[model samples]
Structures are given as C-alpha cells and as structure tokens.
Target: MDMRALRYFVEVVRQNGFRRASATLHVTQPAISRAIGQLEEEFELNFLVREPRGVCLTPEGDVLYRRASLILQQADSLASELRDLRSMVSGTLRVGLPPMTGSTFFGDVITEFRRQYPGVQLQIIEYGSNQFAGALSDGHVEIAAAMLPIEGEGFLTQTFARERLALLCSRDHRLAARKKVTLRELSDETFVAFTSDFKVNNLIDRLCNQEGFEPSVSGRSSHLDLLVSMVTSGMGVALLPVTVCRGIRSSRLRVVTVIDPVISFDQALVRHRDTYLSRSARAWIEIASEVLGFHVDPVFVA
Candidate 1:
C-alpha cells in the first residue's frame, strides 16, 4: 500500500473524521475518501464504518494502525540515514548543555561521537537547565542534557542516568568528616547555592522546606565546579551531584551524603516534542545511551 494512503488512514483515525483529517492534511475530503477507498479495495476488506458523527475503524483497521505507525517511524529514520550518507558530508549541530554536567560527565560521549562523525561540528552552548529548556522549546538547540523532574510541556525526555546529590564542605568545617548528615543537622548552615537558573536550586529549596527551614543563600553561581570550590574555600557548604564531586580531587574538601530523605535527580536527553531531529542528532543520542545506559527509546528518530 502507499505510505501516503497509510498516513491518511492514520490521520483520519486520529482526528476521528475524514473531513477533519482532510483539513489537517491540507487535502480535500474527496482526495482522502478516494485514498481510503483505494486502501480498502487493495486489502479486500471494509476497514472503516461510516456513521453520522464520523468514521470508526474496524478490528483490521486497528491492527494496521499500530503497525503503520511503526513503519512510518522506521521509514523516516531510514530516509534521514540515507540523506546523511549522500549530501551531508559535513554538518554542524548546536546543542544546549547545563553548566553542571557540561564539563565533567559528558567527556567520553563527546569524544566517541567525534571519533565516529569526524566531519560534524558540535557547537555547545552552556546555560543552566531552567534557561536551556526555554531555548530548546524555541528551536535554539537540537537537544539538551536536562535534569529531571522537569516542570513544563512541549518536551520529550529519555532518562539516561541517576545520581545522588552530595553535600560538599571545607575539610576544616566541624561536620566535614562525617559519613552522612541529616538535613536537620545543617539547618543553620549558610549555603552556596546554584541560582534559580539551575533546577538544583529549586530542588534544594523544596527539600529544605520539607525539613522545616529555608536554607539561607550565602552565594550563588551557575558553574558546578565554582560552587564546589566555594565550599572548599570555606565560604559556605553546597549540594552537588556525586559524579561531579568525584571528578574533582581536592584534599581540602569533603564529600558527604545527605540523609533524612536522600536527595537525587535523574539526567535525561531532552528535546522539543514536535522537532525534526537530524541524523547527526540521532547518532549523538545513540552514542550517549551507550555511555550512560544500555539503551534509549529507539523511536526517537521520528
């Protein structure tokens, strides 16, 4: 059967009327009806029932609907892959990155992607997660590494990793050597927090509120390393991802776990829901899944 006819059938089922589907597909009702008639004739079955309200699909039509959706997704990915092989000898991808994981966690993924697609240029823009989400929705970047539980719409996300948020303090601080500390223990401590631009600041505030006190913000910065360094210099303590703390080896700093409802957040590959992803973008996400997880959603290419 023709892919265009299958698409018309799917859209008709989704919109629940041939007329509505015609409007959505920017075709006349006669054209849609003719396509559906051709499909039914080719398959030798009545796949739809007409009523006063609209059209309803038969059992056979439902089966075709599910399979056709996957086939269309596969077709798009294959088409993109072929285009990458033909005309895109070289291409540039603009990516949004949060400052926290931008420097430390993505080294291997970026290096491997570069090794495989040497001709593709990567333009990395560093922003806090909260700010980057807006850029992503506005078509500013192809994809982003975002911290979850993101609060918004018009985004599709696949979780790649989860890490606990650890408390970092100067070695000379009174609680530095402790293996773990409860939230109440640090109730009065001044905090060097990520600004509102970073989602972690919101997480910190929410958790602290649950613990019955608002953390007094002593300093603010978007850079993770800079925030951790501030803690090491005895300005104030900070909460950071454990993976980030592991990347920095400093004898003057201590990394301790937070208890009384342990704090953690997921890291995900995020993009606009309706965006058209390129071959290079899809390839980068696949490589990142290899680095961070066993697999990601394969249908993301569509």
Candidate 2:
C-alpha cells in the first residue's frame, strides 16, 4: 500500500467522514473516499462503517488507527531528526532545569554559548521534579539537569557535581546557634520543607525514616528562595542543598551541617538514548563538565 494512501486513510478516520477529511487534505470528498477504498482493498479489510452522522472505525480500522498513529508520529520524528542533523549547530536547544540547583553554572554556560554561537537559540524550561523526568522522556527537551539515580533503561546520564544538603534555619531559631546538628536533634522543630515532588524532599524523607521519626512539616514550598524566606521569617526550619544556601546571604538565616551522616545529592545531565543532540548541545555539555570539573562519556551517536 502507498504511504500516501495510508495517510489519507488515517486522515479520514480522524475527521470521521470523507467531506471533512477532503477539506482538511485539500482534496475532493470522492478523492478521500477513493484513497480509503484503495487502502481497504490493499489491506483486505473493511476499515470504516458507513453512518448517517459520520464514519466509524471497524475493529480492523481501530487496529490500523493505533498503528497508523504510531507510524505517523515516528515518521514526523524521523523528519525532525534529519532536519536537526543538517543544521546541528544553528537550531534551538531545548533544556529543562530544576529551580534549586545548577542555575549559577548554567547561566554562565548559556551566556558563553550564546556568545560563541549567536545563531543557536536557547529554550530554558523550569520544571518541578514531577514534570522534569516525564518531559525528558517524552522528547519535550533534548537535555535536562536532574539529580542522580534515575532508574530506567534507554537513558544516558552523567554526574556533574555532588552538592551537600544542609539544614538551614533563621538565625534567631534555637538550632541556628550550632555549627552542626543531627537529624535526631531536629525532630521537635517545625520543618519548612521542599515539596514531596523534589529529590531533596525524598532524601530528607529517607533520612528521617532511617531516624525512625516522621518530620513535623509546618510549611512546604516549591521554590528554594521561597523556602528560604519562610525559614528566615521564622516560620520553620528547612533542609536544602548547599547551592541553594549560597543564595541566602541574609543575616536572618544560618546554615548547619547534618552530623552523624552528611547528606549529599549528585547532580547529573540526563538525555534520551535516541536523541540527536546538536553540536551546541554537546558544547554546553562540555562547558558543564568544565564548570563542574569532571569528565563524562558522551552518548553514542550513529
């Protein structure tokens, strides 16, 4: 069967009638009907049911619709991938980032990259943890900055740096006087926590679970700066990455190390195995390696 015929058949099913599909495809109604009829003849199946309101898919048509949808999607993706190759250094680089970490180094890297390749466009998307992983998986982004231990196959990841997670509180809070505090010591205090969607919050939950006590969460914020504001305002204490603490230069807040066990999370750049990364994307990856002072293996290209 001709691919064009298959496309015409799919369009007919989508629009639910020859008239609608013909209008959409810029063809006559009879032409759309002829294409679907040819497809049905080639496949040896009745693909649609005649109805007064609109055409409905038969069982065979439903199966073809599912497969056709995937085939069309893959074809479009292939076209995009081929287009990306011809102009690898000049197209847009879609990047996803978390709010808390990597902002400092990423800003400088982006600036330097733009200076070097002004033709390349940058689309930076800030996503919460719940959305970041899915966005990367669905091809919404070419690369994303994420915390480590991403489970699954068909994904390439490289650790850039390890950030220490510290306990932060307002200077006037009781725990602020200490340079170091244990998880057990903060059991009684009201915690201003990151949302459960974040990896930092997961780490805190695991650590607190290990300590055999659930934290008393007084407040939760998605933004690191907002969480710091809450802590500084004496609403509650928070567990935050050291990178985030660097931004809180206020005298009202103090950073304390978690003793007994120092908690840290590895920051990584993650990409899909099948993604066709542009030259500028690879360049930014190298810049990130330089900024973090680590060597990482590039994803295989074929």
Candidate 3:
C-alpha cells in the first residue's frame, strides 16, 4: 500500500535477506521488518516465509513483487519526467556502457557531451551486456551502449557502429601470419573468451556452432585488456572487436579478421521505448550519432 513499504519489500527480495537490504537502503532492519509486516497486515495475507538464511516469498508476495517492481520503475520515471520540465538541460543523466566501449570512439562522444551540457551530472556506468540491460529496463539508466539485438521488448535502439571481430593470437601461433582466418581454422586452438554475462558469448557460441566445433576455452575474463594479455602470454587466442584491436601495441599479438561467415560485432545505443527523454539524454544520443557517423532512424528492435 505504501511506496516505501513496497520498495523495502523489493529490496529484501533482491538481496534475499533483511540485513543486506537494510544496509543497502541505509535503514534499520527493524524498519524494513516493520514495513514488510505492515504490508502483510494491510493485505491480510502472509507475504514472506522466514528462514534461517534469509526469507522466501509466499505466492501472494511473488505476485505483488512482480507488480510492485513495475510500479516502482514507473514511479522513478515519473519523477525524472517531472524534472525534465525545467528550462535548463540540467539533471543527472545516467548512461551504461560495456567495459570494452572505451577502446572505440565513445570516449570522444562522452567528452563532447560534457562540453555541451556542463550543467548536467553525467554518471557513466561500465557493465557487461546483461547487467546494463537490466539497469536500463529497470529505469536505473536512461541510455546504454550494447551489442545489437538486445533481447526482450519495450526497448529501442539507434545504430552506433558495425565491425568484424578480429582474431588476436600470439605471434608464435601458426595462424598469426594470415590477414584473415575462419572460425573453422581456429577450432583446434585454445580460446580466451569473455565471461558468460556478456552477449558477445552468444555470438561466439553461434559462430562456433556453425563451424561444427565448440571453442576450447583456456580462460575467461570480463576485462578486454586481460583477455588481450592472456593471448599475448600464449594462454589462448581471443576474438576481439577490430576497433579495440587497433589500440593494442604489442608486437607479439597479431590481429586477423575472421571470414567464411565473418563474426560481426554491431553496437547500438539503447533506451526504453516509453521513457521520457530528458534534454540531457537527447543531447547525449545526438552526440553519439554524430561521433559514430550514423544518422539512421532508431531501430525498433530490442
């Protein structure tokens, strides 16, 4: 019934405990407990089943949790939308980016955005594809840059850039001398892949499947530089964006393009379809388009 109670309930469910949720919300555990107890009493239903480790949600609580999450998301957007009524293009603009995005032209885009909208507080978050998609969908961030074909609905995308994934191998590898290589050729070699949370893994899996072999992964990492380092140390070969590969100055590394079904890495700036675009958000998108040189219409895909 109460917004604060609902938020407390949601955080408890998210953190799977009372103490952690209280810590996260900067409130006392008794406050959260009282809030949840009040919600249950108000609805005349048992919402949670207490456990030693944490707590489990009753069926009623599960249903309320789903609905309350959406309600809170909308409430957050409503406040932001109200703030957008101000004359100045000033407010907090939160944008999510993949960790590897900086190796591309996005740094320049951020610089230009700050130059134009100095009054706006720009909060940049670096998260992998899955994490940021959740952040964007939950209204925690206004816009995000991610690999194209973002899953789920209620989101729209504007194209950023498209480039092939280049193979990075140590100079001692037999394929290092080639300008281009196919996925089939690298089947026998050890692979260094991004962590499972990245959507890039989906592309890698599909390409590897089409090539009739699974990648023999030697290591996994979330950092691009670490992956490149692993390849440099001869730990394994890696597939990286060509834009990122351009910045690698190691002589021991060879950047070769993949072909015979080239693995394309297409990136786009994504935002919720119905979200109110603040002036700051709009300016960031426009600057990204200008920097990336893509003037196309917003792609209505997920």
Candidate 4:
C-alpha cells in the first residue's frame, strides 16, 4: 500500500471519522474515504467498520495500525539518528560521576574537551559511588565513573586510577602522634562515616568486620567535603580515599597511611558493552585518560 494511504488510514483511525480526518489533513471528506477504500482494496480485507456514532477498526485494521505506528516511530528515530551522525560532535553527552574521584579529573578534562569540541554539550550528574553503577545499569546515564569491584553481566568497566584509603583525624587526636596505624589499632576509636548507601562505607564495614568488630560510627554525612570538615573539627575520625584527603590540605586534619592490611580503591569508567558510544562520550573518555596520564582498561578488581 502507498505510504500516503497508510498515513490517511492512521489519521482516520485517530480522528474516529473521515470528516474529522479530512478537516485535519486539509482534504475533502470524499478524498479521505477514497484513500481508506483504496487501502482496504489493496489489502483485500475490510479495514474499518462503519457505525452511526463513529468508526471502529476491523481485526485486520487493528493489526495494521499497530505495525504502522511502530514503522512511523522508527522512521522518526532514523531521521534523528541520521542528523546526529551528520553532526556527531554537536549533541549532549550525559555523564554520571561519583563524588570526589570525579572532581579529580573534571576540571582538566572538561576544559580540554570544550577546547576540542566547542559544539558539544556536557551534562554531568554527581552520584555517590554506591549509586553510580546503578545509574548506568538503569540507563539513567550514558556513562559513569565509579569505584572498582563492580560486577555484573553485560557491563564494560575501565580502571582509570588507583588511590589509597587513608585514616584521617584531627591534628590533636591521639592517632595523629603516630606515623602509621593498623586497622586493629582503630578498633576502639569513634569514627565518622558516610551514609550506609556509600560504597566507601561498605568497604569500611567489610574491613571492620574482618577485624572482628563493628565501627563506632558517631556521625554520618553524604558529602565528602563535609565529612573531612567534621574530621578536622575532631568530631570523629574517618577513613577517606587518598584522592580526597590530598585535595583538602587542612592544617587541622592529619592523614596517616594504614599499614597492616592496607586497602586501596580503584576509580573506574563504566558503560554498557552492547551500546554504542556517542562521539562526545568517546571524546570525553579519551580526554579523561589523557588528563589522568593513564589508559583506562575495561576491568574491575576487588
């Protein structure tokens, strides 16, 4: 059948009458009726049932309507995809970034990317490590940066950097006098922690569990900066990634390396293996690797 006839049939089905479809299509009612008649003749089946109140689709018409709707929708999407391909670097790139580690590379990479692709728009969504992976899996973001140890089927993970997890405390705290400490040494100390939702918090819990004790969490905050501030104020001690601790060189806070059973976390770039990366997304990933001085491999380690 002609595409035009199919379009007319769809309009008539939508409007529920030839008169309404003709008015909407700017054609005479006879023309709309004739188009529907021609479609039915070509298909060799009755497509619509006439009623005094309105028109109703026959069984075959219902099937054809469903297929026609899908075809039209795909046609529109194809047009959009063609336009995007013609100007590959001029669309929005939606990125999901975990806190702290994301900021480490954002400034340099974003600056360089903008300089390279002036037409591209970058949209960054900040999520905690625990939520970043989920955002990517659920298709809420096109790309994500998260802490390592993420495992699932059908995901592509790239390790970008390795950072130590350090013990942070107020300068006046007793542990500050020591050059280094072990996880067992902090058994009795009160700690400041991120919320239960954070991956870092889970790591801490796992370490504490391995030490045969639960952490004495005195305070909890979602923001890493605020957590550091609380540690500096002597509110409580906290274990923070070296990246974050290094970023904030507070005189009131002192950082010590954990010697025994040392723990490290990897920063990763993750995306779906099956999905195609847009030009902007791929460019941003490349910029990230260059700024960090490391080529990220698609792998995760516990």
Candidate 5:
C-alpha cells in the first residue's frame, strides 16, 4: 500500500521474523506487524504464513517481495544518478580485464578516459575470463573487458569485438611455417593453454573433442605473455586471440590462422546488472565503444 509498508514487508520476509525485521529496520515490532497487517488488509490477501523457525512467504508475499525489491532498487538508482549529476565528478572506477585484453583492445580507450576524466581513479586489474562474472557480482570491479559469451543472472554485457583465435607455435615447431591450421591438425600436439578455469581453455578443449580427439594439454598459465613465451620456448603449441597475439613482439613465436572451422572469442564489456552505473563508469563504456567501433545495445539479465 505504501513504500514504507512495502519496505517493512520485504525486510520482515528477509529477516524471517517480525522482531529481527524491526531491529534491522530500526522500527518497533508492533510497527512491522502493523505494516504487514495493513498490507494484508489493503490487498485482502494473506502474504506470510508462520513457520517453525520463522515466517515463510505465501505465494502472494513472494510475488510482492520480488516486485517491491525491484521498485526499491530503481528508486535508489534514481537517487544515485541525481546525486552524481549534482556533484563534481570523481570516483574510482575499478575495471576488470582478462589478462592482456586491456592493452590490445581497450588500450586507447583507457588513455582517452584518463585525459577526459582526470579526477576519476581508474584501477585496472588483470583477471582471466574465468573470474569475470564473479568479480563483477562481488563489486571487485565496476566494469570489465571479458571474453564472451559470458552469461549470468547478475550481469549486463555489451559485445565490443569478436577476435579470432589462432594457433601459436614456436618458430622451430613443425607447424610454425603453415599459413593456417585446423583443430584436428594440431590434435596430437602437446598444448600450452590458459588455466583450466578460463573459457578459452574449455573452448579449445571442446573444439578439439568435436574434431574427435581430446587435446593433449601439457601446461597452463593465466597470462597471455606467459602462454606465448612458453610456446616460444618449444613447450607446446597454444591457441590465443589474434588481437592478443599481435601485441606479442616475438620472432620466435608465430601466430597463424585457424582454418576448417575458424574459432573466435567474442570480447565484451560486462557490468553488474543490478548496480547503478555512476556517470564515470558510463563515460568509460561510451569511450570504449567509440574507440573500438562496436555497436551495442544494453542487454540486461532478470
């Protein structure tokens, strides 16, 4: 019936009892009960049913709680936007980056952002694709450039670029001089891959298996430089995004195309779906899109 009542109801449902909810909301138990009672009276619907340990939501209560929570979040987001507009800009924008993605893809964007928003602190963290979702959700980073397709209920993603993955080998290796190679062609070769948690690691393995044999993964590292360095050392062949490979200035490492089935990783900028984007973060996103020539629409999760 009222925002206060809705807040009271949601808190009660969250804290599981009137006493705890009142304590959490800094309101009295009677006020909480009175608010819940008023909601029931107004809707003529039983919202909560008693449970042994606490209270459980009735079907109606569950539905109302969901809507009320979303409404409250929207209200808070509106306030944040207004507050940012009124204040002189400056806040930390923690950016999550898959190892080496920043330098290859968003390097110019980051520099341009610094020139425009000198007051904003841009903290760059080198993380792998494996931790993109968790890092965003946990507020470890406000924005991230990750290898897609990254799907999670808590994220909103905008595809910036789709880069091809190629076979990288030491110049001395047997396949190093080839123009292009297929997944099956490299099936038996010992492989240097990103750590097992990375999406690229799984993708390489999956494509290899689809070609009928599992890849022989010999070693793993989370760093792009390390992977190529290992390959140059003749440890094994590696698969890496072309953009990343281009940045590796090494005569000993050869970056060749993947034919047969040209595999690629989609690079996207990911943000937490439910968090309010400060003006600073939004500006960074726009700059990234402009610099990368990526046309994207806001894709949100439920």
Candidate 6:
C-alpha cells in the first residue's frame, strides 16, 4: 500500500470529510477521494459510509485508523532519527510565541539561535498563550513559549523565566505619582486590556477578582504598543510585564509595580512529549535555557 494513500485516508478520517482533508493537505478533493477509494479497493472492504453531513468510519476503518496513526508516527520518528545521524543540523524549526511578551523573553534567544545554527531555518509563529496548545497539537509549531502551568497532559515543559505584572498609565494620571499600587487602588480606574484570546487577559481577570472588583475596560488590543498608546492618550491604564513596561522609552507613561498581592506568571518552553525533537529544536531549547533560564553561556553545540 502507498504511504501517500494511507496518509490521505487518515487525513480524510481525521477531518471527517474529503473536502476538509483536501484543504488541509493542500490537495484536490477528487485526488483525496481517489486515494481513499484505492485503499478500500485494495482491502476489498468499504471503510467509510458516505453521508450528507460527513463521513463515518466502519469497524474496519476504525481499526485501520488506529493502526495507521501509529504507523505514521513511527515513520516520522524514523525519518527524524535518520536525519539526526548526520553530522550537521539543517532543518526548519517552527516555534510558537505570544505576541506581546514573547519578544521580551525570546529576543536574545532568537538572535543567538540564528547565529549558532545558520544552516537551520527558524520559523517563528505568533500565537497567544491561550493558543499555544492547539498550535503545537496541530503541528503548526514544533515548540512554543507559554505561561505556566500549561493545562493538559502529553506535554513537557522547561521553565523559561518568571516575571511580575506591572501597571502603565499616563504620567499625568492621579495614580502615576506612586511607585507602586495595588489592584484594589485601581478598582475605579478605566483599564486598557488585551484581547480575550490573550492569557494576560485571564491574568487580569483573576487579579481583579482577587482584589474584589472588576476592571472597567475602555480599550482592548493585541499589540503592546497600541495598549501603551491607549494609556499614553489617557484612555485607560494597562497591566503589562514589568520588563516590557520598563523597556518603553516614552516619558509620557509611568511604569509602576503592582503589589498588595503581586501579580506574576511563570513562562516556559513547551512541546508535545510524543513529538520528535529535531537537533535544531533541541539547540533552541538549549540556548533558551542558558540565556533565559540559567543565565549562563550555552555549551551545547561547540
């Protein structure tokens, strides 16, 4: 049996329809149908039942699905292992990172990774912490940086860094005079928050709840610069990473620590435990661990 045909069949089953599988695989629907049809003909059994909404698997199809999945996983592992046997590392490493805080944590790691591994192409996918799990599961990214503790099983993590959340407001604002403030003090202040999909928004929600009042949100944005701009314009105050707030060059904004119950989150490098880690991916983790986690020189490659 053709491995390509097996892949097509598995994708069709996973997607529940030929059209969706075709879209995912970037192949034509007729091509996927032909491949699955060939598989059924080879086995001399009907594997799927055609329906208006989608396709359903027969008992034989279910068995084939389970077995084929293992086979594909093993096949991929074998290929990765063979590649590792080479003396040099040269492959694409796809990594997912949050839009706002990712740069603060990974900018140096990214620079060092590229410098050390010029043969490997690095692909950085921007995803919020909330989306990292799905992105890693879907194979869109091989590894990711996320806020810990990442939910769910079948994943492994290495601690990246820990940081406290700080408050940003216009320099002229009433609370700007203080070097530190608590969530309760800002209970009545208008807030500029991140979009719902960002995990920082979740952090904000929890902090507000702990302080006994909900934030009166006046603006929401995905970009840190825009959020800062909103705060600078006196639209509302924003909560951001202390490091990020400190890096802002604007004299019009105040970066104050949040206390009385300091809001903080741990960051980590996460990946599917079952997925094969290419040399490039391993190198990335090494550099990140050295620079961001251990604060030492990386000796993994040389």
Candidate with the larger lDDT of 2 and 6: 6
Candidate 2 C-alpha lDDT tens digits along 151-225: 666778887878888889888888788989988888788888878667777788888889888888988877777
The residue-by-residue lDDT of candidate 3 on 230-273, one tens digit each, is 99999999988888889889889999989888889778888888
Write one digit per residue (lDDT tens) for candidate 6, span 1-302: 88888888888876789889898889998888888889999999988897898899999998988777667756665676678887568767888988888888889999999899998889897877888886666455778988887777777777667878998999999988898897899999999988887887888898788889988999898888899899999999988888888789998999888998899988878887777777878888878877875532232222
Better of 1 and 3 by lDDT: 3
C-alpha lDDT score of every prediction, in listed order:
0.81, 0.77, 0.85, 0.78, 0.80, 0.82
Give lDDT: candidate 5, residue 81.
70
- Per-residue CA lDDT of model 4 for 1-302, tens digit only, reads 57677777877776688888888779888887888898888879998998887799989999987777555544433443565779867777778886666777677888898899988778887777777654555444668888777767677888778878889999999999788899999999999988776787787889889998899988998788888878888889988887777888778888898977898888778886544566677788888889888765534211
What TM-score does prediction 4 earn? 0.70
187-263 per-residue lDDT for model 5 (tens digits):
78998888866778777778788899988877888777777778988999888878777777888778889987889
The prediction achieving the highest TM-score against the true structure is 3
Model 1, residue 238: what's the lDDT?
Answer: 87
Query: Which stretches in model 4 have alpha-carbon errors above 4 Å?
Result: 1-83, 296-302
TM-score of each: 0.71, 0.73, 0.85, 0.70, 0.71, 0.75
- Cα lDDT for residue 16, candidate 5: 82
Where model 6 places Cα greater than 4 Å from the true spot, the runs are 1-78, 293-302
Worst 10 residues of 3 by lDDT: 293-302
RMSD of 1: 12.7
**In model 5, how large is the Cα lDDT of residue 201?**
77
Ranked by lDDT from best down, the candidates are 3, 6, 1, 5, 4, 2
lDDT of 1 by residue, 1-302 (tens): 89999888877876689889888789998998899899999999888898889888899998887777656655654565566778653477777878887766678888988999898898787778887665665455679988887668877888888878888899999999899999888889999988788988888889899899999888998766678778988899988888888887889999989898798888888886766688789888888888776477765556
Per-candidate total of colliding backbone pairs: 0, 0, 0, 1, 0, 0
What local lDDT does model 4 show for residue 171? 92
